[model samples]
Target: MLKNVAVALVDGVTPFEFGIFCEVFGIDRGDQGLPVYDFAVCAAEEGPLTMADVGFTITPPFGLERLEEADLICLPADRRAPVRDDYPEPFLDVLRRAVDRGARVLSVCSGAFVLGAAGLLDGRRCTTHWLHAPALIRRYPAALVDPDVLYVDEGPVITAAGTASGIDACLHVVRQAHGAEVANTIARRMVVPPHRDGGQAQYIQRPLPRTACDTVGEVIGWTARHLDEEITVEQLAERAHMSPRTFARRFLQETGTTPYQWVLRQRVLLAQELLESTDDTVDAIAGRSGFGNAAALRHHFLRTLGTTPNAFRRAFRGPRAVA
Candidate 1:
């Protein structure tokens, strides 16, 4: 039902989140029979806009006028930085008009700040980069900010956490409007996994560990490859040639979480992928994902994913297991 999609660009737009909007809506896949969106890369400003980094200049085809014609409006990360007080008033005005006219709106990552600035996110379930979550909540007490989730679809306004989560949010919109078959096809064409487990916090780049300089990184890579193995901090410390206390602190510094928590999160991610793409039973998936048993898998799954494995599989693959 969506025919027109417009992405609003301004000074300081993040290239990656902006790309998510373009890739999802701008591409014409008529030969492949995908539903088409009349995508327009428009600008609040009349001329060329500068990005955060040098060497990238975006020239928008339409002006603020495009906002009225848009069925869906995507606000990618803006340069105004999440904690800033002031932004271009004209840009905020355009966003306000689009929402007042019934266009579905989406904001990826810190773009939620833009929406918040426009007053569109008041009393809405929204998310932003986890690092900015506390600030957003503190600044705008009306917004319900959930930092632990991948994306939140609150009626006509959807907000995604971080940059790459924008991809998942867009694919989710396609899936809801079209179906999983079409969404999966688009994802395959893009050479990206159709869905990601957990939120962006899991992928947020952390400063590397200082103490376990020799082997911590290697251990992380190894743990990823051998997720099915029973691993412990002592074992990992031995591998890193550091004492347990030092390894734990350094690991937390490097990954932004305790080592055990990191491993559990990664295992959950692995299980999520298997659930989406394979016909493995819950018990089998539990074993393969290093959860040891179905009960343990269910405990972590509910705590982290907010759904049971069976429920997630059902949502992704329908009534029966994929064969």
Candidate 2:
């Protein structure tokens, strides 16, 4: 149903954020049996649009009029749009009209500010880059902002957190519009993960210890390659040449999560990959992903992703999987 797509660009547009939309929606991937969107980049007024910090400008062939017919409108991060009170009114008006007509809107990072300006984020659960989440909430107090997660989907409006999370949000849209197969295909071609767990918390950098030891880091690599085995803190401690308490402490300090939690998350990620890529039975996937059985896998899946495996498969597989 999402056949037509448009990226609404303004002055000071961040190239990476804008490129995210173009890579996801603008490319012609028909040869891969994927949906080819009628994509366009539209400028608010006309003429050359300036890029942020890149010392360059681009001429968008389409204007605001093109947005009226788009099934989806993407607003990429623009540094000025979020902070400036005088962002173009015509652009905001068109955004409101497009959503009023039942077209979905997606915002990557600070672009949520554009939706906030249009009053589209009011009464909707949304998010932006964690650094800007407080400002977004302060400006639009009516908006429910969750700063921890990578993205939030509030029906008509989808908002993604900083930077790379835009890929997850765009792939989610593709998965919803087409199927997991198409989304997975696109992800494979792009050489990125089809799904990512956890939140921007993991992305926040912390100063590393000045010491020359990275025992926990090596253990983490080993754990990833051996997810299917029953891994205990004692076993990992022995591997890391530390006591159980020390290993647990080091793991948390380095990974921001306990060893058990890290392993469980990895298991869930493996299960998700298997579910999306293979026709293996639930029990088989559970065994392979270290859940041991279908019931355990179901419990973890429900707790982590808030959906049953069968329902997730149905949503992604669409009509291709036999009931």
Candidate 3:
């Protein structure tokens, strides 16, 4: 029954993240058999609103009234200037009322700050851009800031980390409300991966050189090709021609996660593929994905994905799937 999605934009909002919300939920993609969203751009105030470095202003059709009818309301990131004690009380009131009415609320990047200021995020698990997470936590200790994951879906509220992950979270919402098929079609249209494992740290300002010579692309490619084998941090370090400590530092800088964590995600991804596409048994899939056994695979999958392999496969490929 969910249809109308209202996005609340404020001054100095990050254009790309705001645009992603519109693209994912606002577009009328009914031609592809996708459900259409009754999308509207609403502002906390009336009149012209300036975007960052865009040299133009956008006039939103609805004001705070948009929140009253919104099935889902999105708060896009804004600059740090708006968080002072005197900031935007009327907007906060609207958000509080919308949430009270059981409308789903979402925030991308530092828009988490706005929700936090409104007290909507208190005692809730949330995430934001890693660069702003620590400060956000310090400013509002009541919020459970998790700077690690791409997004967290806690019942009626969802918060996505950083900018691009906003797309990932929005796609996830599509996947949840509709299904994976619809989400995948949208992702294909956008030319982005349907999912990116781990969190925003994995995509931050990587310390590795952008050029091939100074990067970990080759080594990572090699690791992916050999996930069935026992791989260790030391072995990966040797492959990169660096000591374990240095490699660990650089790996986190490049991938925003430890080598082991990266391997785990890839291994799970391989397991998921096997579950969906092959008639492999759970034991066989686990062995091929480097989980050693079915039990091990089940543990990690349930821990990270919140579902057992069997249930996930059944939901994706159908009940007849061997998982």
Candidate 4:
């Protein structure tokens, strides 16, 4: 199992992203019967490393050599990461050696850029924060970049989407290394979910309606509340007092996705929440989440999340429903 954990810090590391790994791996919960990893925070540079947009500097207790002993090495978000190409050669070398030696590496948000610079992400599926997705693609043409998901676990290399998604990715590591019960316990202590729904896609910003019209916003709220019912763009357009084509155009402009995609994502999110929080069977969740039947729910769940509903529930709900 994963026991030794180390964080490799470069200059301008964002505090929250760095904190995620520390919270997940560095804490000693031996009294609670949880495994305690040998954790260290190591610096890549010589002097006090500067934090981004902050007034203070940090001097890590360990050096880059500590990473050579780690079972898992974490890279947190650095403010200059998108344009940073000056990572120390020794720092990059240790990363490559870690992978070649069967150790795992995880990058949170813009930290993926550091992995990209080290050529760790070449030909592997990875992700960064959605805003940096385009720049990541431009910088590393060989990487398979998926911008919508919360995280990707490509065997030895794992990448998370943004600040809070770092929490998800770290818990995922814990879940895989330890088990669901241990990960869920850690999540409860941190006041976070062991698993989360949807993706960074929900948080992406879009241009508002040019005419300052809030009709689309109202329709979105209405659709969210009535997700169990059959919803069509025609019905939504009539409610917005606009033609179907006009409504579709305005919806895309205001929401960055089509009406159909928006509803499908919402329904999937609802199914995920119900599966996590309720004792409902798959068929019940399907009816409540607007999937109509278990087969439909399973199909969409796989297409959207790459996992079946029963497996997702088993991950989060302790295998209560066997489908």
| Residues 197-288 of candidate 1: C-alpha lDDT, one tens digit per residue | 54554334333334445477888887888889999999899988899999999898876689998898888888878888888888999999
TM-scores for every candidate against the unseen true structure:
0.66, 0.64, 0.64, 0.68
Off by over 4 Å in 3: 81-85, 204-323
- Better candidate by TM-score, 2 or 4: 4
For model 4, the stretches where C-alpha displacement exceeds 4 angstroms are 208-323
Across 95-205, the per-residue lDDT of candidate 2 in tens digits comes to 999888999999999999999989999999998998888789889999999886798999889999998899999999999999999999999988998997566643433
Cα distance off (Å), candidate 2, residue 73: 0.3
Clashing pairs in 3: none
Q: State the C-alpha lDDT per candidate.
A: 0.83, 0.86, 0.82, 0.90
Using alpha carbons, what is the TM-score of model 4? 0.68
lDDT by residue (tens digit), candidate 4, 1-323 = 89999999999999999989989998899999998999999998785998888788899999989999999999999899988899999999999999999999999999999899899999999999999998999999999999989999999999999999999999999999999999999999999989987666645543322434588888988888899999999999999999999999999888778999989988988888888888888999999999999999989988877677887778666856555
- Candidates 3 and 4, the one with greater lDDT: 4
Full candidate order by TM-score, most accurate first: 4, 1, 2, 3
Q: What 10-residue stretch in candidate 2 is worst by lDDT?
A: 203-212
Candidate 2: where are CA atoms >4 Å away?
205-323
> Model 2, residue 321: displacement in angstroms?
37
The local distance difference test score of model 3 is: 0.82
In candidate 1, which residue ranges exceed 4 Å CA deviation? 204-298, 305-323
